[model samples]
Target: MYTIPKTSTTDMEVTSIRLEKELKDRLKKLANNKGYQALIRDILWTYVQQKSGDYQPQLSNSDIRASLPATAQQEERCVLTGKVIRPSEGMLLGLTNNGDMVPLSIDSLED
Candidate 1:
């Protein structure tokens, strides 16, 4: 599973900014049917994540597992962490308590 870091915007105060009429029109067209505010929020969030080195490309368990060597796959350990995982452990990805995702074996994953 891919987790997107979220910051609560419920109590966020609204602020206004001015943009060129041409730029605003371009943004409106790029936003498709979504509200301009939402589009801007998403764009800013992605930028922040990239700048902070917090953006991680989401990959499926199969993709991660396939990248490992056959011996590692047969051992049922996380390719990144080399941590032994039991077959009953839940989650397809090797997620630590700190919420970092790592490559793990699909056979060891719990339903």
Candidate 2:
């Protein structure tokens, strides 16, 4: 699932967690225009989706810029077919037009 709907600051609860100074600096650099806290929320949402097996992305074959062969070091779901790519299984990394690299089952290309 995509990130939850955004709400105003008033709708959010205050929570605090400590981060290493170096990591905080790195997050700031990576955050850019989106702001670090928002980025952190997005990351949390993505992690939750993946763990829940609800992380399917809405992509199509035409959306792929290229397909590069690869082997899964860990389980992954093919973006197009939602098929599981078991560890050590040969798969393809579909580079999307938007630059995201996603997993694809080898058989996903057959049809």
Q: What TM-score against the true fold does each predicted structure earn?
A: 0.43, 0.75
TM-score of 1: 0.43
Q: Which portions of model 1 miss their true places by more than 4 Å?
A: 1-10, 58-111
User: Ten consecutive residues with minimal summed lDDT in candidate 2?
Assistant: 50-59
Query: Cα lDDT of all candidates, in order?
Result: 0.53, 0.84
RMSD of 2: 2.7
List per-candidate RMSD values in Å: 11.7, 2.7
Clash count, candidate 2: 0
What lDDT does candidate 1 reach at residue 44?
77
TM-score of 2: 0.75
* lDDT, residue 84, candidate 2: 84
lDDT of 2 by residue, 8-101 (tens): 9899999999999998888889889879888788788877776788776657788888999999999998888778899999999998898889
